[model samples]
Structures are given as C-alpha cells and as structure tokens.
Target: MWKNKHITFFITGGIAVYKVVELIRTFQKAGAEIRVAMTKTAMQFVGKSTFQTISKHPVQTDLFDQTTSAAVAHVELADWTDLAIVAPATANIMSKMANGMADDFVSTTLLALSVPVIVVPAMNVHMWNNAATQRNIQTLRNDNIQVMDPDNGPLAEGYSGKGRFPSNDEIFNYIVEQTEDVDNSKLAKLRGKKVLITAGGTREYIDPVRYISNKSSGKMGYALAKVAQENGAVVTLISANVKLPIPAGIDVIQVETVEELAQAVQTQFVSTDVFIMAAAVSDYRPVHFVDHKIKKSADSANLTLELEETTDILKSLKSRRTKQIVVGFAAETNDLLNNAKKKLDSKGADIIVANDVSQSDIGFGSEDNAVTILQHNATNIKVAKANKQIIAKKVLEVIVKRLS
Candidate 1:
C-alpha cells in the first residue's frame, strides 16, 4: 500500500528509540523510500550510522550541513517528503514543534513542511501525564497534526504504566490509513451526511441483578462509527454496554436494554441520513421479572424459566424509514450467506453484513473479522480475514458507491 511513497522519519532520544529501527524496516519492505533525521540527543540511544545503513540515505543531524548545495538542508528535505513521522517524540521536541521553535533540523523541517505529520510519543508515565505535556499535545492536535496515543505497559523507568510505545504493526496501520495515495475526492465521501450507528450487545434483564447478553465487544460497530466520522459524516452513536472509549466528535447516546436502544434510535431516526444496526439484540427475554434476587432452595434442584420473543428492531424501522439508507448485521454459526440474504430481505436493510461466529480467531471479541456483505441488486462483496478497521473502511467504500 505504501509503494513509492516518500516518508521522512525523525528520531529523538528515548529508550524506545530502538523500536524505530523496526518501523523503518517495515516501511522499507513495503517499498517506501525513507529518509532519516535525528536529534543530537537521539544519537546517544541509536547510532547515526545504524539509521544511515538501514535507510540507505545520509542521516541529517547538523542544521547547517552544506553537503547538498541545491537548497537549505531542512527545506530541501521538507519539500521532498510526502509525509513526516516522529517516532519516540519526547516531551522536549514536541514542545518545540508545538510552540513553533525551529532551532534544530527536525523542528525546522517540520515547521516548513506542507504535508501531514504524525507524532508518536514515548516517555515516562509521569512525564506523559504532566499537565504541560498534555497541553502541548492538544496544541499540536489543534493544528491538525496527528498525535497517536502511547500504549500502556512497561516503561524504561522500570515500572509498568501508559507511556510505552505502540507495536510496529499498529504504527504501520496508522501510516497506511493516512498515506495510501487515494484521490482527495474519495477521502471524505460521506461529508455532510449524518450517520446513526448502534453498537455493542443489548442486555435483556431477568431481574435487577441478572440479565442476558451476547459476546459482542462492540469493536465492529465502534470501527464503523470511527471510519464514518473520519470520512466526514456527522456521526451519532447509540451504544449499549461496551467498555470501549468513545470516538472524538461523535454524539453518543448510551442505552442498556433493547427497548432503550430502540427508543434512542427512534428519536434520532428523523435526522439520520444513514443508519447502521451493528448491535446484537437479544432474541428473547424472561417472561417474568423479579425485583429481588431469587433465593436458592435445596428442595427444587430443577428450574424452568419461560422466554418470550423480543421486538425486531430492524423490521420495526422498515415502515418508519423514508429516504434513509438502512444497514444491518447478522452473526450466524451456520449458513452465513443464506441467513444474511434472508435478513437482507426480511429486515428491509440496504445491506446485511454477515459473519460466522463459529470461528475462533476472527469473530466475537477478536480484533480481526471476515464478513460477506449482502445487498439487493448488487453483487455480494466478501472481505477476507483482516483487522476490523480495514473491514470497516471497505464497508464504507461500498456504502459510498451506493450513495453516489
């Protein structure tokens, strides 16, 4: 995906500096041309010669080096780069960049660049949490720079916390999403559209303390919300009980049961341009409700509880939907395509995304997924096993085609 892209990598002093090597190599293997720049402090942790050998380009350290007579070194490099990434961006350098200080090569080039910049911070837990550092990070974000949050784990300070650098694969995925060379017209295809998305699994209560729910982690729905918002949709997320963090710039309404979820969707339906029902609504609920915990008795070892069918949320919306596009999801253990087709018709959905929950690796609670999209009057599209984020992007692409 990164073929022929010009990526400039900047390194700073941190124990996580070693991880930048693998990041450069990953970009190199993807056929991207890479250039390296380092701070004088970064040289202490990783050698300049090491980066020079890996990148096959001279590492820029001195701001005034006259080796390239074409133009100023920083400006020349800045113009050459398609994108800039600062790995192990310490608090010091981030502050400089945030405050428009151009005393060094990295900061000077960053200030001069017209391309996107991605900052990956790595520092001690306390330093990362400090108020001043956070302010600088927010300032950079306000300037439209992409600042990736650091992962939580063991740090070089011999303690476990939230300042560890993320894995190379995660970093690579971010790069791919930001720099795939797609046309600008296709990037924000859903701009000015209002998207309503339901996520997670609804809980059908048996009592105040007990309920029934599914294994849905809400990852897929959250992914769709994120991708849709990134595509310039005004997203409203009606979520169930999922522990994931809410995406920025989304209007979120939290609900716990099927009825509550239905109500929230109905309230937002009028203003929605597109609706995605990604939640796993319970099929049945206990016929009776117990206000208090049921006491266990030794005399009755066998217990039987009656269940009644719950309202089908998607079918209920069919009559109410006017010009809005409706999408649904089906999690079936068998007959995936047939079931999805049935759902696509019965629910009156524009598309039904079906997946096999029988698989151990790529369904329910997993980071990856494989799905087949079923739609009327359109060819079925199958997305092979991949990260949910990638699958979400493909799903949006299909939706864009339909919308256009």
Candidate 2:
C-alpha cells in the first residue's frame, strides 16, 4: 500500500520518539518516500540529524526555515504528503491537532494537509486516561481523523499501562487497512447501536501458577470489535487472556477464567443490541482450586484432576435476551455444519458461526479465517478464507441486515 506514496512523519515530544526512527525505516523499506517534520521539543529526545539520516530528507523543524527551497516550507511539505503520520503523538500535540492549534512546524504542516492523517499517541497512562485527553481524542475521531489506539504495556514511569507506543507492524498494517477503498455508506450502518463482543480463549486455572487455555489469539474478536466500531456501534469487548492491543473507542474488560468472562458479558448483555461470543471459552475447569503449584511426585508418576462444567454463557443468555441479537461461534474438528446447526438450535442464537478448526491453515490463532454463518430458516452464508478483518466485515453485514 506504500508503493510510491509520499508519507510524512509528524514527530512530537515523547519518550517514544526513538521508536519512530524504526517506523520511518519500515515505511521506506515498503517503497514509500519519507520526510519528517518534528516539533522543537521532539528534537530534545532525538536529534534532527538522525531523522534526516534515516529519512534521506531534511527534517523540517521550523515553519519558517529560511534555508528551505520552497516559498512556504510547511505548505510545500503538506502538499507533497499523501499520508501524514504523527508518531509518539503527545497529549499536547493531540490537543493542538484536535483544537486546530498550529503553533509548531509539525502541527502547522498537519493542519494544512488534506491527506489521510493517522495519529499514534504515546504518553503517561494518567495523561492518556485524563478526561481532557480522551475528549480531545474523541474530537479528532469525530472530525474523521484516524487515531491509532496505544498499546498496553510497561510505561516509562516504571509501571504497566495502556499508553505505550504500539509496535511498528501494527502501525503498518493499520495504514494499509485505512488506505484501502471502503464503502462509506456502510460505515454508519450501526449508528446508535450497542455491540458487545467476547474475544480470546478463557483460561481455567488448576493452581496458582498453572492453567489450561486454548489456541485462540483473539484476532477475530478484536477484528469484530474494530469493524463494529467503524460502523458506528458503541462497542464493548470482553477479552479473555488476550495480548492484542485494545481497539480505539471501545470499552474493554479483561478476563481470565470462564466465570470472569461470564460475569463481564452478563453485565453488558442487558443493554447490548448485538452480542457476539467469539471467545473460545473453556467448557470445563478444575473442580478443586489449588492454592499452590503442584510438586512433582517422587513415587507415583500419575496425577489426576477433577473437572466441572463451566457456565454456557450463550445458552444462559438466550432466555434473558429481548431485542438483542446473540451470535455464537462453534469451533468444530468434525461435522462443522452439523455441530453449528445443533449449537444454533440449542443455544437459541440469532446466528451461529462455525469453522473447521481442524484445518491447520485457518482458525484458532490464525490471522485468516473461513466460516459458515448459520441462521434459522435461512440459507447458510459461506465466507471464503480471508483476512479476519474482511471476515468481520462480512459477518457484520449480515447482522446489520437482521437489525434493520
């Protein structure tokens, strides 16, 4: 997607400035011509020469650089840019962008550009969570700006949080997705709707240090959440032991055990217009919880654990649902259609998505998937193997029709 593209990096003051150097290199490697515009405070962390050396273009530090060849330096660069990326976009810069304050070279250039702009925010957890910062982010989104959600990880302040800079691969993929031609008419199909999605594999703990989990990477669930949000649904994601970055503008509740996931979903299911159970929840858990890790036996080599059934969240919700459309997923090794049909009937779901996880290429941790959507008295919709995002879009199309 970057081929022959004129991409500009709008660098800002943040500890993650050094990380942008690698991101610039990644774009260049993908055949994009890169230039950088940095704030004066940004230069404090990384030298202008470093970006110049890496981007192979003079870093624009001043809006009025007399040495520049163009009549208006910022306007010239803004006109040249096909895409603008604000890496390590500080809360300060985001506030400026949201409010159209162009005090510095980066903000001024960004304001002049008509091209697609992606703001990658990185800052202290508290600052990222501040009501003012969140309002600014929403304002940018409302203005049709793409604000990439920050990753959840250890922060520079010696603690872990959600304001960490996302990995380069994530930013790259997001750029590719955002650049693709999309049906604008479908974007707001779910306006004013509430969507609740479950993701990842639930972990059933046997002891303090040991547990059982599945191969679910939570990609599909996360994809569903992203697509739902793009369609203007207020999304809530119940994530079960997933490491994926949280999608922007969605409420996320992290869970480990089936019980925890059940609680989270049940809490939100009441007000949800659509509920998607994409999580690979554990069917069973150890009946007895061990406070400590079990030790290796000296005499007997065998150890047995008693297991009990977990709550069937979908079936349990069937009786309580009124206007809500419940979707369930059946991951089957054999008899995919038959199993899915059975689940659709027994679980009383509006839609049952079934996939052959037995295949090694798709399902369970794969980025791509193929699924059959089963609905009562309706022909099954077979979605060919495709990226999880595409699959998500297709699934939501069907759901939106039912909603209409």
Candidate 3:
C-alpha cells in the first residue's frame, strides 16, 4: 500500500521520538518517499542531521531559513505531501491541531495540507487520561482526522500505562488496512451512523472470586468497531473482560457479568442505528450468590450448585428497538445453519452470523474467522476464512447493503 506514496513524517516533542527512527526505515523499504519535519523541542531528543541522513533529504525544521532555495517552505512541503503522519505526536501538538493553532513549521504545514493525516499520540498516562486531552482527541476525530490509539506499556516515567508508542508492525499494518482502496463504497454507507457493538465473554459469578466465562478474546468485535469508525460511524463498544488494545475513536463501556452487559445494551440500544451483539454471554448464573469463595470439602464427595437461565439480551430489546438494524452472532458446535436460522427468528434480529466453534483455529480466541450470514429475506452469504478484520469488512458490507 505504501508503494510510491509521498509520505511525510511530522515529529513532535516526546520520549517516543527515538523509536520512529527505525519506523521511517520500514516505510522507505516499502517504497515510500519520506521527508521529515521536526518541532524544535523534538530536536532536543533527536538531531535533524540524523533524519537527513536516513531519509536522504534535508529535514525541514526552520520556518524561515534563508539557506533553503524554496520560495515558501511550509506551503511547498504541504503541497508536495500525499499523506502526512505525526508520529510520537505530543499532547501539545495535538491540542494545537485541534484548535487550529499554527505558530510553527510543523503545525503550519499540517494546516495547509489537503491530504490524509494520521496522528499517533504518546504521552504520560495521566496526561493521556486527562479530560481536556480526551476532548481534544474527540475534536480531532470530529474534524475527520485519523487519530491512532496509543499502546499500553512501560513509559519513560519508569511506570507502565497507556500512551506508549505502538510497535512499528502495528502502525504499518494499520496504515495498510485502513488506507487500502481508501474510498470503498460499502464503507461510505456507514457514514454518520451510530453503531453499538458488544464484545468478549460475560462472566457468571459462582462466588466472590469464582466465575464461569468463555474463551472469546473480542478480536472480531474490536475489528468491527475499528472498521466502523474508519467508515465515519460514531461507535460505542460495550466490552466484557478482554485484554486487547483499544481501537481509536470509539467509546468503550466495560462490563463484567451478564446483568451488567444487559443493562449497558439497554442504555445504548435506543440511540444506535446498528447494533452488533458479538459478546458470548453466559447462559446461566448461580441461583444464590455466595459471599465467599466455596471451599472443597473433605466431608462430602461432591458439591451441588443450583443455576438459573439469564435474560436473553436480544429478545429483551426487540420491543424497545426502533429503526435499528440488529445483528446477532450464533457460535455453535453443531447444526450451525439450523441454530442460526432459529436464532434469526427467535431473537427478531435483522441478521444472524453463524460460525462453528468446533474448529480450534478460526473461532473464539483466534484472530481469524469464517461466518455464514443469514437474513430473513436475503440469500445467505458465506464468507470464506480470513483475518478478523477482513471478516469484519465482509460482515459490514452485508449490513450496509441492508441499510441501503
């Protein structure tokens, strides 16, 4: 996807600046023409000459340097750029971009650009979670700029948290996936739509510390959320217990038990235009709550526990739904199509996506999936096995077509 692309790197003042040095090389290897513009504070961490040596072009740093032959430096650079990436984007630069403040070379050129811009933010965890910073991030998203979600890991402050620079592989893959065929018609249908998605496995507590849960890793739901956001949908993700990097530009609501998940879905379901229920909620819960962890008894050979069925979230929301296209997932070990068809009717869902979880490779915790899409009036669509992101795109294509 980077072949012959005019890509510019805008470096800002951050501890993660040094990490971008090797990242630049990776892009160049993929046939991207790279030029770098650095903030003055960024130069304190990495010198301009280093970038010049690596990119084989003079790094643009000064807003008005008479040494260069160009008539207008920032404007010329902006006109030349096909795509701009702000790596190690500091909180300061992000704030400036959000409010259209351009007092320096980097910010000035960014303001003049007509091409796509990608911002990768890295900062102290406290600053990352600050309300003002978050508001600025939302403003950037509202302005149609793509802001990458920062990774979570060890930081320069000797503690681990969010706001760490993403790995080169993560950034490269994201660029390729999000920018490939940048103007897909299927994706355009999702613009300005409100999508609510559920992910991961809901827990059923047997005691204070013991619970029952599934193996769902939430990869498919996260991929759907990412693609939906890229397609301009305002997305809210209701996530259960899953450890994965949060997708950029999506609101996340965390829940633990089936009851919590049901409540969250009820709160967001009314405002959503599309609701995708991909979470694996436990079928049953303990009849009585045990305040303490149950201990194994030597006096008895076995312990018996009572259980009761949990509320079916999709069925409960059927009456409350208005103009919402509901999608549900049926993960089955046997009779996939029959079970999925039954679910489509019983749950009153507009679509049912079924996949066999008996195969260890393509379902649950895996990164890839193949699904059979079933709808009431439309013909069934079978998507071949592929990465979760690819599967997400196919699933969304079907949804968007139904919307049209």
Candidate 4:
C-alpha cells in the first residue's frame, strides 16, 4: 500500500482510454496525487475535463503551453512526476517510444522520466503480436521500462484477445510493488533462491475408463508461484490434472498422477531452496489397474478392487532435503491445529498450511482460503479467509523474513 504517492497517467491514443478515468479516480481515492496527459487522438475518446475533475490538475496535452516556460511541456511533465504510467498505450505509441520518437506531448513527456515508468499496452491482438510492436516493447523493457502485459478479454476490436488493458487493481499492484522498498517486497528476502511447487489435483485410476480426483483448482499454487517469482526466486511448477492457464515466467512441468509428480519433484529437488506442496494429491489408487474398461454383466452382483498407497512426494523431498525450505498444506475437516502440527513434523516441512475444509467457499477450487500457517516449532498463526493472491503474498513474505 502506497500511503501517499504520485501517479501520472499518460493516456495514449486508444479506444480503451475510457477505462482510465476510473483508474485515475481509484488512485486519487487511495491518497495518491494524480495528473493526466492525453494524446491528441485520446481526446476523441474522453474529454479533458473528465481527467481534470479527478486529478485536480489541468490535463497537459500540448508541447507548448502558456502556463509553462519555453521548455517542452512534455519533458517538463515527465521530469516533474514521481512515477509515469501510460495506459491504453497504442501499438504506434509503443513503437514510437521504443524509437525515441516523442512527436506528441504525451510520448515526449514519457521519454524524459527519471523515475519508474510503467507501460500498459492496449491494441488489437494482431498488432500486439506484430514484430515491430513486440520489438518496441522489448526495447522498452531492455531500457528498464516496465511493461504490464495486456489482459486477455473483450477488446474494442470486436473480439476477445490479449490486447485488453489490465484491470485498475492489477496495474495498481504493479506500481506499488515496483515502488516499494526491496525489504518490503516478497523478493527482498527471497532473491537468488530456488523454489519448487506442486499444483492442481492428482488423479487415481480405478480402471481403464474412470479415475478419482478432487476439486483442487490449483489457484493457490499458481498464486504462490507468481509471488515466488516476484520474490526473485528461480521457480519450477510441478502440476497435475490442472486445467488452468499456464503461468508466465515459470518453469511448468505437467503430470497426471502422483507417481509422475513425485518423479518430477525428486528430479529437481537437489538445489531447490524452497518446496511448496500445495497440491491435493490422491491418497489411494487401484492395486491392479484394469487394462480395458470393464463391461457390465446382467448377472453381476458386486465388484471389489484393492487400493494401494500413492507416493508421498513431500515426505520424500523432505528426506532428501537438508538446507532447503519445505512447506506443505493440510486440507482438514476437523482438529485443524492438531492435524496441521502433525503434518509440520511428519512431512518435514518448515511450514504447513492448516485449513478447515468445512468452509466450502475457501478451499479446493475457491478463490479464497482461510489458513493457519503452522511452523516447525509448533508456533502457529491463523490467517483469515482472504483472496488467494493476498495469502500467497503473505506466505512468501513470511518465508523470506524467516530466511533473512
């Protein structure tokens, strides 16, 4: 949370500019001092008064304004702000910025910033993937400019794609994280570390035709991986039966069974600094798997199949792990603290997420989870049900702090 910050929203020529008004207001209400600068084409989408009303400052758009000295208004605005964020950054504007073509006031002001600059690109999916635009985006990043990937959703181009501007909350979080001190970030305490995480649900084969599985959505694992990446760790994600989108900037290894997951983790555990087993691995599987789907018979009375133990991936990792940080999760129905403490010692994890399973809204496929983070020392802390993203951040911070 930025208690008081300065955020300059540079509105570029794109139809998505309309959404920026609310973003400006969000910043202002968060105790941030905001200023706006719009491109000439942006005015065609939103009026200047709309921004001026929320920012409480004249929307600066002209390179030459009477209120300012002979200096370029664009350069002056860029030099004056604490942070620069360009929203609805058109492909053309992106190309121009990459090439240092500050022809307009908005682009020019952006080129002069000494503080952190965030570029939120919005354009047609095709243009977004164009070689030229991508080169510009990469060039900007190579020059230390932060580019927030566009959201994948409905676009003004009449279809859905990755060109949609990110939500106000997403952009806000990025800015706050970028500006926060290293000690306060998830990375300050975690940089240069290695992490391995398990995600999704494990499948147990009953026969050739059917399998048993849980409702583990893997949202928590993905969130933890993302936060771990932010904390500057080398992250490898081991997944099972996950239908979720692949996370960007992580090494993802897909698996379908507990055996495969155990193999993956064991193969990669030697140098890992942190291991987070958040998956809902299957406990039992058929002792003798059917080669083919069993057919029904008219005289059939009953059927029985012996079940066997699935590999405990976390425990194996713990045995082989000496200096690495091992963390596990316990999805429980009752005796939450008791079960959690058991796992903390049994799994050899440095920490365990002990959660009550009776709350349908906060576990196994829910966006939120209520957990008591139990440590190896039997010390425990109850974290109320909250968004998975927030929980992941908190967990990452705790690990980093303990390590520090």
> Which ten residues in a row are the worst by lDDT in model 4?
66-75
Q: Which stretches of candidate 2 lie over 4 Å from their true place?
A: 1-184
lDDT of 3: 0.89
* Model 4 alpha-carbon miss at residue 119, Å: 26
What's the lDDT for all of these models?
0.87, 0.88, 0.89, 0.80
Judged by lDDT against the true structure, how good is candidate 2? Answer: 0.88
User: Which number leads on lDDT?
Assistant: 3
Over 4 Å off, model 1: 1-187
Order of the predicted models by TM-score, top scorer first: 1, 4, 3, 2
Worst 10 residues of 1 by lDDT: 179-188
Question: What's the TM for model 1?
Answer: 0.58
**TM-score (C-alpha, index-matched) for candidate 2:** 0.56
The RMSD (Cα, Å) of candidate 1 is 17.7
Candidate scoring better on lDDT of 3 and 4: 3
What order do you get sorting by lDDT, best first?
Answer: 3, 2, 1, 4
lDDT of 2 by residue, 49-105 (tens): 999999888999986774454556786677567678999899999999999998878
lDDT string for model 3 (22-73, tens) is 9999999998889999999999999999999999888998788643344567
Which pairs of residues clash in candidate 1, taking residues 3 or more apart in a chain or in different chains? none
Model 3 spans > 4 angstroms off: 1-183
Model 4 spans with C-alpha error above 4 angstroms: 1-183
Clashing residue pairs in candidate 2, if any?
none
